[model samples]
Target: MLVKLGPLDAGRVADLRPYLDLVPDPRARRGRWYSLTAVLLICACAAVWGARSLDELAEWAERAPDTLLTAVGVRRHPLRWRRAPSRTTIGRVLGAVDGDALDREVGAYLADLHDASARAVSGQRRVIAVDGKALRGSARLTAARRHLCAVTHHRAVTLAQAEVGAKTNETAHFQPLLEPLDLDGALVTFDALHSVQANVAWLVETKKAHYISVIKANQPTAHRQLAALPWRDIAVQHTTASTGHDRRESRSIKTCGTADELGGIAFPYACLAIRVHRRRRQSVRRESRETV
Candidate 1:
């Protein structure tokens, strides 16, 4: 696994250098003998093995001292010199590391991993999904629930994120997050709460990213007017209907007209309206058994 990571990648490990550059022993510092790089490597290796807290890493340092040294590019297997630094030291180093810098380095490394996977496959599918999720454990800080707005590309890899003070502030964070992302050719999806005129216009005008957003009661007037439009009136059309053998049925409708007309449609009216109709028919077999 360590070999798979390509340890020599300069860009990826640049953030790790600050701690690594420190001389572990002042007396041997001039000779470049002892360094914090070993310590940093040991802690990282321990964490990779599922060591959560620093205390666990300290225990690993004592047990696998030699294996840990070589894993981190410490030059050679070590003869345990005075015990490894306490858990507090490891935690402090990790805490003191600039989070932004670490995040950038980590993201870049992960990107490389994904890039390798992309190359291994003949054709690559890159999909970026943008959504807002509340920090599950964060206590409500105010009357409005604060949401963590994150733009994740390829699922769990978070490209960027911001804290939305409230529903109204979503647009503000959206702009900043989109500004830095390379969204061209990516299908971006969001919920009804973000289906604002300015937001759509921005996605079209600024990022060149395609968007598909849900429409809901939040835009009441628009929703009502859209519902009233004749589906045949549209140029491009989409329709879906489904039936299942046992207690399942579904209906879907979609249509797209000229961007000009879509733009002209008044807010709370139909630029685009999607209705999901569902009906579940109880199986006759189940009914017969119940009756008997």
Candidate 2:
């Protein structure tokens, strides 16, 4: 039978209970030995503390003190024999549950966190960066690699992530990840892979959010047109330089109000066009330059 972990105070383990509650139990009630919430909560806490695999998570739970298990909502067995679910139970429950639903629930929880943080800071605009990465250990065993689209803040707090199927790319999962997020007045940033016109329009018109996407050869015409602009004549320019790890890097950014030459294209609320040029040099004679 399903059970709820009632209101918990603001903390790491407590914050996860609401999201874990959304995961439907796939087990039959007649022979069930553990609640889904308790299993998930214990697993989440274990993962956060550096447990990478099911075996490791189970070991962590087994070694956990009774007080820690109780604090994380793990109930004592009716017979008072076990303080938490076994490793096999954790693996079975995780494998049987709906992965997509779990992802959505986690996203919703992070969105709530972002909203609360925004409120506490007096409406400060948050920066959400979208990127994709592949799981390191999953690639060797299967031809279909596991990739995930992660939305993170500038402060390095990961808000959410969505899985990108083997047949599809990050672009396919990009909008879906942002769909569940409340991005109003927030600035969303993405790499060149997501610099499509439709995405720009949707972010501005539908989501009512601002964006700063890198321009690249993916969109040939837009890249060429943006490159042809007379950036040297722009008045608003910012330049900075830094040196670290035997390398020196410098960047210059130029911004302009609007581009008359590209008037035909409908860029939603198109008020600014920016160009960035970067150069880097290492002590060993390696050098590179990039423009965006």
Candidate 3:
């Protein structure tokens, strides 16, 4: 399995050096002109800008700077570099390429990059957020909505993705989606839906990863145990405030160890129970308050 780097799009500095050589050439030598690697690289590079259709991808490649074209290995003819491949060519070649191979190689490269980044940051384990969402623009294709569960890095690189079954929910697909990645010693966070005992144990015992799970009404026993804690007796231990485009928000956190009065908040392998209160005031238009 190839442990790969993160996204290669703009604003995120990724090492695209190894990407060009990760996959083998799948085209015939008889009529090949453009480098297959260059085309694939262009598609990846353009992804962050939301390009997807063949026409849009090809257009982005054509407008690419000379430096990028040369770096991804666009052919340099005797007189000049050949133009980026056309939309028709891009469609044909990409259709013939091996998606599974590309995914593995990219995953390997991203994993390697994550490991190196960790070393530079004093060995702090990376954070992998596992979540799922409906595939936008696909509601018209299938009878049931197409949903996919995926794991992503703190830096926004996707490690893996798996389609959620029509007969099941995202929680059921969580373990399978994360089974393929190299997540040893990483910190995983998921919404309340995946805060089940089986999933948490699988992550710890099988994937060798730690998790920070949020408890809500989904798990009645745990939720009741946490909500019934003596929060009135505990002082707010930490507070974080942020100011953004049109809003100012603050969160005050109160944490209580499970060693003393609340020893029965049994959610499997948990040692602490925390509560967060959030207050948001958005300009002069809106305001809200919530807690978890």
Whichever of 1 and 3 has more TM-score, that candidate is: 3
lDDT of every predicted structure (CA atoms): 0.57, 0.76, 0.78
Q: What would the per-residue lDDT of candidate 3 be over residues 1-292, giving only the tens digit for each residue?
A: 1213334543332365466467777888998877777787777776656686888888898898887777667788788765777889889888988876677566666667677788799858789898887777767654766787867777777677767778888888888777767788888999898998898988988999888898988899989889888999999999999999879999999998876455667787777888999999996778899989
Q: Which run of 10 residues does model 1 get worst, by summed lDDT? A: 283-292
Top lDDT hit:
3
Score every model by TM-score: 0.59, 0.86, 0.76
Q: Compute the lDDT of residue 154 as modeled in candidate 1.
A: 57
Clash pairs, candidate 3, are: 2-108, 3-108, 3-109, 4-107, 4-108, 4-109, 4-110, 4-111, 5-109, 5-110
Q: Which residues of candidate 3, in runs, are more than 4 Å off?
A: 1-35, 46-52, 60-84, 141-145, 242-248, 260-264, 280-288
Task: Please give the lDDT score for candidate 3.
Answer: 0.78
| Candidates sorted on TM-score, descending | 2, 3, 1
Best by TM-score: 2
